[model samples]
Target: MSRGAGTAVGVLLILTGLVWAGQGLGLIGGSFMTGQTRWLVIGLAVASVGAALLAFVRRRGG
Candidate 1:
């Protein structure tokens, strides 16, 4: 994908992941994911993927 697209996806993923993580940790409530260990794991994985994408973009000199 293009650098811009990659960056955008990376940012979006990171934000989404953070929100999920918050819900999982019960920091952000209201959803079924709240305080769920599975959500927490999923969130972390998503965030890590986002971070990796960002890193790739940076390494590409974007």
Candidate 2:
């Protein structure tokens, strides 16, 4: 994918991960993931990957 598209996807993933984590922790509520530790962990991992991808791309002059 193009650099811009990749960046957009990375941002989206990060935002989604934050939301998922919130929902999982019952902070956002209104979903099956509420109070689910597994989802919370998954969200954090996804957010970390997204952040790392963004950093790597930026360092490479994407």
Candidate 3:
């Protein structure tokens, strides 16, 4: 992927992770999803994915 595209993907992953975290923590508010722990688990996984994407962005020729 192009450098910009890779960076954007990385950023998006990080944001998604944060949102999932909020949902899990019940901090998102506004009656979004119906579960708590579920959000948390999903958030954690997304965050890991984001971190991996970031790593990918930082790798040589990425």
* Best-fitting candidate, scored by lDDT: 1
Better by lDDT, candidate 3 or 1: 1
Stretches off by above 4 angstroms in model 2 are none
What C-alpha lDDT do the candidate models reach, one value each?
Answer: 0.94, 0.85, 0.78
- Residues 32-55 of candidate 1 have per-residue lDDT tens digits of 999998899999999999999999
Model 2 weakest lDDT span, ten residues long: 53-62
As a TM-score, model 3 comes out at: 0.80
**RMSD to the hidden true structure, all candidates:** 0.9, 1.0, 1.7
lDDT of 3: 0.78
Better of 2 and 3 by TM-score: 2
Q: Could you give candidate 2's per-residue lDDT for residues 12-61 as a string of tens digits?
A: 88998998898888898888999999889989988888898787777777
TM-score for candidate 1: 0.93
Model 1 — which ten-residue stretch has the worst lDDT?
53-62
Pick by lDDT: 1 or 2, better one: 1
Error of 2 at 39 (Å): 0.9
Cα lDDT tens digits for candidate 3, 1-62: 87678778878988988888887788887656535788888887888887787788778455
Q: Best candidate, TM-score-wise? A: 1
Off by over 4 Å in 1: none
